[model samples]
Target: MNKHFLWFFLLFCLGAAAKSLKCITCHLHTQPDRCRRGFGVCIAQKHESCMILQIFQDKALQLTYMVCQQFCRDLTFDFNNRTYVHKCCDYSYCNYDM
Candidate 1:
């Protein structure tokens, strides 16, 4: 009984430690593949995940946005010949460039 309890406690602690999220935050993304403004990291809150939004026009990359967002979902849409992609992830920096 003691051995089982110890293993359970250790596993629970590891799980809790893994729940924290760290994501890259960037606003003014430049064309040469760099963050020009608002570049940093954000510790995601409860129910939040790392997110990336990419906008493309004429099948070419127009802009890239990254942040930690709550209630984000993976999706894509097109408007006025522009394509918008919204992606979310739970792992650390998973949305950095994807």
Candidate 2:
């Protein structure tokens, strides 16, 4: 019984540690300072990185935001001639740099 309790306690601590990734989230258009939107903790399945994304329209910056994501790959996509660029990193509050 003691061994079982010990294992349960260890597993509980490990689970708590892995449960969430704290990240900063903001949209430049809505919150210009990029800090007013405050922080959010992500507990989604497979989410391992914090991401910063910038969307540009006709080479002009339109929007900037951050989120927690499962994949940490820099990517770009275009829609209606607008370009969306995403930069991602693993570690707490890493999106603040972007």
lDDT of each: 0.90, 0.73
Q: Write one digit per residue (lDDT tens) for candidate 1, span 1-98.
A: 69999999999988976777989999878576789889998989998999999999998888899999999899999999999999999888887858
Please give, for residues 10-88, the per-residue lDDT of candidate 2 as tens digits. Answer: 9999998875566776644333444445455564347468888888888888777777777678999998999999998
**What is the Å distance of residue 96 in model 1 from its true position?**
1.1
Q: Which stretches of candidate 1 lie over 4 Å from their true place?
A: 1-19
Error of 2 at 12 (Å): 8.4
For each candidate in turn, the TM-score is 0.78, 0.61
TM-score computed on alpha carbons, candidate 1: 0.78
Error of 2 at 48 (Å): 2.1
Q: Name every residue pair that clashes in candidate 2.
A: none
